[model samples]
Structure formats: C-alpha cells, structure tokens
Target chain A: MTGSPVPPELYAEVLHFYARQMQALDGGDFESYAATFTADGTFKHSPKLPAAQTRQGITEALHEFHKKFDGDPVQRRHYFNHVVLEQQEDGSLSSTAYALVLTTRPGGRPDVGPSCVVNDVIVRDRGALRLKSRAVDHDQEFAAVAV
Target chain B: MTGSPVPPELYAEVLHFYARQMQALDGGDFESYAATFTADGTFKHSPKLPAAQTRQGITEALHEFHKKFDGDPVQRRHYFNHVVLEQQEDGSLSSTAYALVLTTRPGGRPDVGPSCVVNDVIVRDRGALRLKSRAVDHDQEFAAVAV
Candidate 1:
C-alpha cells in the first residue's frame, strides 16, 4: 500500500508468514517453523556446510533439526529486521532480512549470538508465500551468549 | 526491473551498492565498508541492541573486530537471496532480503550458522542508495560469521 503496487493481500500474507515464523521460533515450536516451508524446501547455510548441502531432500532434514532443539531450551527469541521483499518474474517472491537469536537461561544476560542476513526464495502455496529455500549469512559475531 | 516498477537507474544503483558491500567485506576492506555510511549512519543488530551505535567514534571497536581474521585459511562466503525493495514515501527505499553466511576455518569443517532477515532503510546519496541504517534480526544467532 505504501511502496510498490503489490496486491494488498499479497503483502499482508507475506508479512503474516514472517510474523508466524518468528512466533513459532520464539515459542520453541520447531514443528510450525519447519512447516513454513514446502516439502522440497532448501535451507542452505553455506556451500561448505553439510546440513543444507543441496536443494533436494530437505523436508526430513528440517524435521531432524527441529528435534535437536525440541528440549534444549524453554524460551527462545528470533528477531528479524531490515526486511526486503522482491517479486520475481514468475509471480513468486524472494526476501532477505537480518536475524538475531537470543536465549534465556534462567537468570543472566540472555545469550546473544551473531547477526546474520537471511535469503529466501518463496512461492505461492494456497494463496500464501511458502519458503522454498532459505540461506543465512552471519555477518557479525558476538560473545556467544546462550540465547 | 522485472518485479516492481522502480526506475531502472535507481534499481541498478541499489543493486550495485549491495554488490560493492559484499566485495568490500570479502576483500577485508572494512574501511571502505564503513565509508559506505554517512557520518550519522546507523548500524544496529536488533531492537534490543544499542541504537544507531554511530561508527564515528567506534574506530577502535571496528579495528578490534576486524583483527580476528587474517583473511587466509578462512573461507567466508555470503549469499544474498530473495531481495525485495520498495521506494518509500520519503524518497528513501525500504528493502528486505534473506541472507546466508557460511564459514570454513583452517582445517575445520564448514559451519552454517542461523539464517538472518535483513530490513534496510536507505536513501540515495550522490546518485547511490547508500545504507542509512541496517537493523539486523537474527533468526538463529547473532554475528555467527563475518559477512
């Protein structure tokens, strides 16, 4: 409504998707977070990391990763800022943003981690944008806080 | 160009700026990266971090951080994806993108940190959309790798 001529509904749905992703991460609901993507969704961290080595066979991988975080912490925060969204030639959308993850371990300064940039390729699924692939670039490092 | 109705020149400039930023970082040219901002430019990690944290007086801080990498044996790669940019009401631009940071230390396996979503507010300065404030949100951890 304020910038480009993207359909109001499209923009709203995208924003909603982002909000839901953040909420799921903060709530420690990895199931929901993992569901935000399509079955063949790729989550590449780097070309060197084996966790997300390729664009194929990631649905099961996400499930496994979520299981790792299931019982690690009761509370976690996923913060996103400086988000930019672009519509591609095929009507699909792509976006990037900065993320900061914070964790709380009972009492003490929340563990603060690095600041990274996120790159995502999304598609329209059931009238909403579902991430097809997500890549994160950590640009800043902190003292490795717990959260 | 293919997505939004942004003027071609403005769009090209923005793209160029990002490419330059990435090149500077990869080449370990922190001074050039820092010069991309104005005297009052802001570099923020998250909502909870310090505001603007102006770089004008952070020379020592910048040097200390840059010293960690000797630029060899550490292969740092950053991927920018799904970029969406909008021309704002104030003639500035608002953008969001997903970022992925991958790092490989000397004789170590590559580590893929968390994903980040970047929200950038920029203004055209001297025919370029220089970054004004970059507020990063960590989808996992903060500054996991040097971008």
Candidate 2:
C-alpha cells in the first residue's frame, strides 16, 4: 500500500519543535525548556524513574537536576538522531525520537551514554505548538562515572 | 537547519510495527503482542509508570492487564493517527506518534479516551526491524477508567 501523505506545515512545525527541544536542553536553558510545556504539562524520564507529572513538578525536578550538573565545568550535549512525527486529532501531535547524550569535563574526552527513545505529546498553544508531555526510554544503564 | 530524511524501509517497518501493535492490543492477540518484542525488550506504559524491563516481564504484565480488564467486558480500540520517523546511528530508528483509543462494551456505545503519545526505538532484526523499546506519554488520565 502507498504511504500516507504528510502535511507541509505539520512537517515544518515538527522539525522546528524538535530542534528547539535539543537546543534548550544542550544550552541549559531550564526556563525555556520548562516553558515548552503547557501550564499543566509533564515530563516523564523513564519507565523506572519518577515522572514529573505536572509543569510545576517538572520545574522543581529540573531545578534539582541543574544543581547536580550546575557548574559550566565543561560541556553537555544532546544529540537527536532519528525522529518520527504523527499527527493526531485537532492539531495535536505525537512523536518518537532517539537521543544520544555526551557529557564531558574540561580537558577530558566525552563519553557516549546509552541510546534513548523519547515519545512526546504536543498541543498548539496560541499560535505555536508546545510540548505537553515527554517520555524518555533509555536503552542502557547510565554511567556512574565517566568523562 | 533542515530535518533529517527518513529511509523508506525504516518507515515501512515502523508503520507495520505500530499497526501490528494496535491490532494485537485490540484483537486480543497476546501472542503476537509478545512476539513483537526482542528476546530482551522493554515496554513502558507511561514515562511515570514503572517499566516492564524484560520480554518476560512485559508478557507477564500484559497477562495481568488482560485479566484485570476482563471484568470490564469491553473491547479496547486504539488507533495511531500521526506518525513521524527519524533515522539514527547503527541502522537504528526512532519515531513518535499520536494515538486515540476507543473502548466499547456489549450494547454500549464506544467512548473515546484521552490522547496518548508514543516514542519507540527500533533496530533491524535479521532483515526486518523489531521494537527494542517503547515509551508512552499521555496527556490525560486513562479516562478515569480503561480505554
């Protein structure tokens, strides 16, 4: 069977949205990252990890995350590889993507982390689409210590 | 920057996989559902919910899920609406999509459940791609009931 056709606007929006997410994460712009969610949005890290069920919850958790990795000691990177977007009813969108992250200390070689699969729900807020929720599925265990 | 291109084979595999997943869930083909995973795969219901970390763990959980919903005596119908695909390293792929579920009971009208987002990681198994992991994110509660 032939594949379904993709809407151009939806396509463009999905790409832009994905980029913004990675940029915000890599840039350590917590406020921008938090703003991507709806006022009542959530962020779910993994199946076994605790989930931030609401916007406020996510903000609080992010604060904690930043505290641990707070120093601009070196570099933190989020790499987006494969991404899939599906349109839902009423302008809502769902997407899946793979992310590879590397965190390194100054003058140290970067270590590659486990592959991650992410699922996200997005809604059109005002005139732009914003993430409503994020679910991260990690394929391997996190490294306890590495540069 | 432009979005990355999705390979045709990868796209087909994803479409087929999700279709199978929807069919299995709705058709009550637990065997097929179990077959979709790798020998050591994981299934996460919601990022917040505990994940089924192993193939057997996921299968056992589904069995429990089936029994719990049996008393409800209803058919759970789920559909994948929008789908987006992204390619990654090592021939792996990632995707995101939106889902709408409709549940119906005998002599009862179908009720629509809140929307859901799906993120999946896929790897080429032999010649075809199989699900390595799935992370589900939802915007609404389970309609306060099953759907």
Candidate 3:
C-alpha cells in the first residue's frame, strides 16, 4: 500500500480500538467486545464455520467460543502483530494482522492454541470506528481443530 | 506516543524489513535472518534466557532454536501484528508488536507455539534499517515454556 502518511489521530484511534477490543475479549465481556463492531458486522472464525453476522450473532458466537474451554480452568490470551492498515478506495479502512492464541490450564504449562491471519474492514459509524467485517483465516491444519 | 505523523517512507521501510525477516525465518534461512540485525544487535527471547548479542550470537541462537524441534518434520511460521512504530528522542525508531509462532508437524495438526510481545529498537546504518535490540516478553506461563 502506497499513500501519504497516515494521520497520527487515525493511527491512534485504531490502536485504541484494538486495545479495548482485546481487553473485552480477555475479560470475557462479550457485550463490550460486540459493541466494537457495527450492527451488521460479520465475523468469520474459519472457512468451514458459518460466519457470525450482526451484533447478536457475533455475541453468540463468542459465547460459544468461550464455552469450548469449559470444565477446564484455562486462561486464554490472544496476541496480535504485523497489523497493516490502509484506506480503501471506498474511504473505509482495511487491515491485515496475525494472531496467536495461547491457553494455560490451572497449574499446567501453557499450550499453543491456534494461529490465524485476520483481515478486517473498519468503518466510521456515529463518530466511532467499528468493525464492518472480519475474516479470519486459520492455518490449514489448525482450521480443522477450530472448525 | 504523541507527536507528528511518522514519515511514510520510514513506516514503509520498517514494514519491508519485517517482511524480509519473516520470510527468512520461515524459509529456515538463518544466514538471511541474521543479516536483518545490526552487527551488535541483541535478541532476548525471555528474561531468564541469556541474551544473544552481536550478529554471530544472534545467528547461533537461531540455529539452536531451530534444533529444538529437530527429529520432527515441522513447518514453522511466524505472524506479527499490532506493530506500532515511533521516533524516539534519540532519533532511532522504537517499535512494539505482538507475534504468534506456529508449528505444524508432518501429518499432525498445527499448534500454537508462543504468544509474545516484541519491543524493538531500529537504526539505520549504510542506508538500511536494521534491528539494534529486540526484547520479547512472553506471557508468564508461555515464558517458562519458551526459556
């Protein structure tokens, strides 16, 4: 992507948005996490899994995601890196990132959970940046487990 | 974190450097990977592990790192995101990012290896961007496994 420098304010806003989104997910606050997206936002966890569209759908999907680790007191942490944001021709922002998910059981060693690539479209709504669509591509082998 | 916008050229350069570095590591080309750093560059995998200083030291450490997964035909992939770069007071560039290391063994499902935070100091010498220091902070439990 080639263009003029990204404004500091825009970069700062995107950074802040991701921080809040991560905190919400880590704290199990699905409500807050869902709020980061637009009303018609869409989340694709993997190619095989049906996409979660709309705020309610996203929230339910996240709830089910959290339930996967039920019966085991495991802590989940997500790390993101190599985020590249660019302004699309339509004026919305498009982003690509990589994610690492780690899980640790009580008194047990940490285990790698999954690694995936994230592609997102961000739009401004009501004066705040929100996710329009997020398509996550999991590694081929990992996608089998994730789905 | 508050200042004028980062020059587009500088931002592009850092992005380009990381792309090359990741390619080298994924391709198991230690020679190319080691060349990404300065002569006195340092790599700190974790607090408990001894730091690797200088070009030779960094290359040797990577060699040993790759050896750990020996005897198993595995593919290693590194994904980075949330990269934030700022100009430091000393005129060098300081960057903070998150990384996901994934490994896939032959006929086995892909697994998450480690999720860590990467802090880097980048400098220009001979007209190319090179890493001067890279300090990685893994999650508490992950750090134990990494070291």
Candidate 4:
C-alpha cells in the first residue's frame, strides 16, 4: 500500500496506456483496443449492460457498439479526465476516471453523449500493464437518443 | 524522484482534503473553503475568467457566485472523480480531476450544470496539504440559466 506521489516513469506509462487505448478505440481498431486488456479481462459498459469477459468478449462488445450505427456517418470521441490511480496491497492498481463521450452526425452539430465514471483494476503481466476489470458507471440512464 | 506508487498515507490525505473542501463549500462555509488554499493561492474558474490570486479573492469569487442566485432556492452538488496526483520535482503535487456540478431548483428534477477539468498544484504547508494554484478548465461555457 505505497502512498507517495506516483513515480514519474510509472505516471508516464499510465498516460501512455490511456492514449494508446483511446487511439485504438477511436480508430475502430477493436483488436488493438481489446489487446489493452488481459486475456481474461472483464468490462461493463454500464450497470444495465451485461459484463463482457475475456478478450474475445471485449472485441465483440465493441463491435456491437459500432454496429448500432452501421451506415450513419457518425464521429465519436472519448475524453477521459481526473484519473486517480491507487496501488492496492495485492500489487494491482485501481483507477477511477471520468469519461465524456461526444458524438457528431453529418451536417449536425456535435453534442455531449454521456458522462461516466470508469473504475478499473490493472495488473502487470509480462512487463506490461493490462486491465483486469473495468466498470463504467453512468451519471444518468442512457437515453434512446444518445449515441 | 521516487518511481514508486504514492504512499497510502498521502493518498488518504488527498482524499480527505477533497472531501473536506467539498463539504465546506457545499455547507456555505466559504471561509473554510478559502482556507484550504495557501495565502497566495490562485484559482481560475475558466480561461475566460481572471484568476483569483489571493485568499480574499477566492472568497469574493465564491460570494459573487452565490449572490447570482440569492433569491432562488437552489441546491448545488459537486461531484469530483478521476483524481490523478503526481509529485513534482519541486515537492509540489500536481493533480488532475474531473468535476460535475449538479443543480436542482425547488420542485424541479436535478440537472447537470457544468463539467470541468480541474488542474491543481498542491504543497505541504505546515504538515497539511494546501492548494497553491487551481486552474479549472470547463468542458463548455456555462449557460446563462446555470447556477
């Protein structure tokens, strides 16, 4: 349970992980995004949605998210802020962050989609940090009109 | 520079600081809230606004904020999440957090007010953490109707 400020090197690594993960997801590279997690990683987009466990499951979930708007020329951007990381006694890292999703439709102004609280458990595996579990809690229930 | 995870003690202190600061502000104890800053602390609510550079300036800003809705019975709640703390070489701690402000008017359902990215520089003054500078970057400009 170390509690000094996060070391510079580790801080850089954590930021790097987030950047890479966001880039992969934004680019629609599901495979690469899923690779950011552990082989048995689990992710819950919302409490109402079923948890996706396993790398394959994560990839499929992402596919479904994009599939909903298959033909629409929609652009989506995810912004994560206020990331707090704590190392647990068991040597895993616990992270909490706020996420804002923006959606823009063709010829339409961009609008804020949903704000979420993201909680994650990360572990070092083979010299790299990978997410073991991720739970996304939304500030409000998803609206039908949301992206 | 220590490359280790933040100590548990400092982590607990940081959390405590936020909890106390929020409670003080929500409770209308502007003095206590302003006291959380150093004598020469600075806070910029938004890039478009001037920075409040002194403890007296901070109090005045809060006073003005509350004065705007003096006659309305409104409830305001601030939710901060994803707090990331980094220790700097100069012994100051740099933190990044996401803030969500919710406002509810009498007999009205609660609505989200504004979301912000909070960047703060904290220093240990007399064995307690005090904010030296706080720059709040808003995700969007505030609407006239907002609290």
Candidate 5:
C-alpha cells in the first residue's frame, strides 16, 4: 500500500495467475501447468531439491511425478496465500507468498505436507503473465540437523 | 471481469482484508481479529458447527478456543487463496476463497486439518472493510458418512 497507488487489476491478475497454475498441476494437466511459465523458466522445491530449468523440463518432471501416484487414490494441492507483489525495473514482478502443500486421499485424513514460502519472478509474455522463476523454502528445513 | 469493469482497487482491498483478518486470528490477537467483523457479524465453521452470531460472540468463542491449545507447543495457521471477488448490489463485496487449516508442532510434522471453502460477505463500516458473515465447507465433511 506504500509508494504510488497501484492499479487494483494487477492484484487480481496476480492471484488469478496462481489459481490457473495450481489447478492445472493438481488436475494432472502438466501441459497447462507448464504454460504458466516462460520457455526458460525455472522452478525448485528447495535448494536441496532438483530443479526444472525450463518449461519443458517442468512438464517432463510433472509427468514423472504423476507416475508416483499410480494405482493410489491421492491428490495434491498447492495453495498460495498472503501474496505480496513488487514490480521490478526489468519489467518483471517479484511475487512472494506463503504456500501450503495439502494431500488428500479417500477414507484417509487430509495431510499438510509443509508450510513454505514461495518466491516467483513473473513477466509478461505475449501479453500474458508468465513466471520467469520460482523457488520454495519449507519451514521444517529451518530446523537443525543431527548430523 | 464481467458486467462492466469494476475498479481494480476493490479486488486488492478484498485480498488485503483477508490477509489482515487471518493474521490477526493466527497471531492470537482475538481483539484485532474480532474487529474485522461487524457488530452483527456471523461466523460458522460449517452448518454443523456452532455459530458466532456477533462480533462479541466470536471474540468470546476465540478466547475459549484458545484455551484448548494450552500447555502444548502447537501453531495453527489459516491460509486463504484462489480468491474471487464479486461486487454486490448492496455495495458489499462477496469474497470466496479456499481455506486450509494447517497445524504444526515442535519436533513434529505439520498436518493439514482440512481443505475448506470460505464464503465471506464484506461490507464497509465507517469506510473500513468488515465481514458481515462467514461460512466454511470442508472437503472431508462432504464425503458420505454413515449414521
């Protein structure tokens, strides 16, 4: 809310973008999920995890990930909340939000995998908003290791 | 996005209002949390749960609810996302968002209690946004249950 007044449409657009990306991923439509990012976009769950270095990389990774749930009735959903957007001089946007990974299975209780923070660099490609990069850091990762 | 372009500011305001309310509740500032609702506000987690019929009622309920967490290292975080804002004819805003209740304990894995949908009726009170009503529907509760 500080600095010059920002157009309200930008806020809604930012949220709508996430709605599109997450739903596509949860629905197992990796192609639509990958469409939310630029060709050379990058995504990493954490510094300790392998990252997808491009749109195709993520799509392929998602396909592999989808295989893990085979024969089991399970669902994973990513929810982003408390988003804060900052405009960059490079005509990109820095979007920071709290993310929760939720898993649901038939007859079993839903589970929260982790509470994490997600940082995304969003850019306009062909007049559509797309992510340039995304990174996640989980709360448990902050705990000390016994090693 | 339909029925004549509404000011984008309204969209941002709706999201921000949720941000404030959720943080206040999670931070255990019941007074600040209660202030988010109107004097005649109503809140119910679900149709089967008890309802708070007024701001005063919710504040008292929160105080009683806080006692249940006594002596345990636990944290509850409410996350709201995938929000859609609609302008109503009565000058109020109808805000619908997904709600996730996440619980974390020291040295224990964080768990997701439920994936829920929250519908809030937000109205302006002395130029400030306030919730007139809030109702939640959880995914699990929708499943078939035997008597």
Candidate 6:
C-alpha cells in the first residue's frame, strides 16, 4: 500500500473540530462556535460584506444575523462534505468543502438550501486546530447565509 | 506522538465512498446508488420494516420510496458526520455515522429533519468498497425515511 502523505491524527483532529464547532453554531451557542477560530481570525461570507475580523466580531455578527430567524423560528444547520485538505509548507492546512444549509421548524419538513463552497485556513492554536480564515462562497442567493 | 491505529488512506477511502454514494441518492440516481451495495447487501431501516434483502431489492425500494416525493418534488438529502470506523481482522470496515436528512422545494425554504444513526458493514467487492449491510436507526419519526 502507498503511504499516506498526511497524518491520520490530523484528520481525526480536524473532523473532531468540525463536529464540535458546527454543533455550537447549529445549537445557538455562538460563543463556543466563535471560540473555534483564532483570536484574529476572519470570516468572510461574500465580497459585498465586510469580514468578521475577530472572535468577538464573529459572535456579534451571528447574534445579529440570527435576529431574522427569531420571527420564523426554524432550526438552521450546516453540512459539509468532500473535505479536501492540503498542508502548507509552514504547517498550516488549507481545507475546502461543499457546504449545504438546512432548516426546519418544529414538527415541519426539512428544506435543503443552495449549494455553497467554503475555503479555510486552519492553523494550530495552543495545540488545537483553529480557523485562521473562513471564506464562504455561495453559488446563489439563500436567505440563511445572506450577508 | 503515538502512532495512528487506523490508516489515513482508510479514512480517505471511506469519506470518498460517502461523498459519491450520497450524491447518487440525493441526485435521483437509484441505480447508481444501489450499485454501491454488495449484490447480497441488506438495508434495515428499522426493526419494524423488513430489510431490503438484495441490491435489486434496494433499487426497487428506492423507486417506490421516491414516488412519494414525486408529488412534492423537493430535493432529499442525507448528511452524515462524526464518523467512527472500526476495521475487522478480515479487512472489513464497521462504520457508524450521525445522519441528518434535508429537503427543499424549488424556490422554497430548507428544512432539516429528524436525527438518525447509520451503521454499516463495508467490504471490498471487486477491489472496490461496497456496503455489505446498512442499518439506519432514527431518533424520532421523520417522514423522509419512514420506511
């Protein structure tokens, strides 16, 4: 068998990070979600909107963006697949994924939204993987991630 | 650092299997979806329902299942995460995942449905990985995977 270029532990760590981080976002624990990013991390949703440049900014932006959902009150979820990871010479990782957004009201049907792709710069922060940058590019307009 | 018990390539192959297989299911390609299973594969969705006993049966069941969606005509998606894989001594894989089913209509809101867990026995068939058995257990009643 050919040797794997990347370490298996790295894959485990990254997947673990996603499992916890996305749960925080979907579960409305914005603080815990934002904490997965580096202190100076940036989250850029689109070219039109300014990037959330810090952890505090990310939390605040989530709080504001969620205001609209309060009226409709459906649970929002993010599912990512086809995660391709490449390691930089400097030891950081560049990860890309196809992302899907799903929402549902209590006792209602689920609707899967527009297709999107996310590219991220992940780095080791105090021995754990943290996002240094996250750029979400939507193929079309979806109310959930509209910025 | 300790060595990884699981090979990195194993993780890669299992993920690749999921990526292609789920796309086939959500994309309305029942033949392609069923082809991923072993010829004698069994799919048991619940204790109440009899398992789809073979690949042909799996395809037929999918055709019948999608009839319900024809009137609604929304995309049905399966998203899986938190994958845990264990390898048997005989080189087969026992994989488990937390799954989410999403649905959406044309120009409509997306809904995320009930939580489910899927356990599968994956084995090599003609040098390619194929599902030997898939057992999906739902946490609650969800119309999408009612069978």
C-alpha TM-scores of all predictions: 0.46, 0.48, 0.59, 0.61, 0.60, 0.56
**lDDT (tens digit, per residue) of candidate 4 on B4-104:** 25554575577679889988988788889899999999989778889987889999999987998789888788777546677799999887765667789
lDDT per residue for candidate 2 within B1-147, as digits (tens), equals 123466444455566677877798689876677678777878897756787866678878778777977668888987664465667776677776655567899999976543465788888777756778888865443222221
lDDT of 5 by residue, B1-147 (tens): 211233556667776888888989988898898899999999886768798878789999888877988997788898777776667899887776778788899988867667777888989999999999998876665533211
Using DockQ as the measure, the top candidate is 5
Per-residue lDDT over B1-147 for candidate 3, one digit per residue giving the tens place of the 0 to 100 score:
465477865665576467557756665787777777888888897867998998788889988987776665666677777679988888789999887777765445567658878899988877677889998887765666777
Docking category of candidate 2:
incorrect
Angstrom error at residue A118, model 4: 7.9
Give stretches of model 4 more than 4 Å off: A1-36, A39-129, A133-147, B1-4, B141-147
- Tell me candidate 6's fraction of native contacts, as a decimal between 0 and 1: 0.10
Looking at model 6 chain A, which ten-residue stretch has the lowest summed lDDT?
A138-147
Clashes of each: 58, 15, 5, 12, 2, 7
- Candidate 2's C-alpha runs over 4 A off are A1-147, B1-3, B141-147
Regions of candidate 5 where Cα sits further than 4 Å from its true position: A1-11, A20-76, A81-101, A111-147, B1-6, B107-109, B143-147
Candidate 3 residue pairs in backbone clash: A81-B80, A81-B81, A82-B80, A82-B81, A83-B81
Which 10-residue span in candidate 4 chain A carries the lowest summed lDDT?
A: A102-111
> What lDDT tens digits, residue by residue, belong to model 6 across residues A1-147?
112245556766777788888989999999998999999999886756899989999999889888988778888888777565677998889877667877889899866666566789999999888999999965444322321
- Put down candidate 4 lDDT per residue, A16-115, tens digits, no spaces: 4665576466557888878888999998988989999898999999999788867665555566877788878998989998888765554344467688
Q: Comparing to the true complex, what docking class would candidate 5 get?
A: incorrect
Compared with the true structure, all predictions reach lDDT values of 0.61, 0.67, 0.75, 0.75, 0.77, 0.77
What ranking of all candidate models by TM-score puts the best one first?
4, 5, 3, 6, 2, 1
Q: Supply the TM-score for candidate 2.
A: 0.48
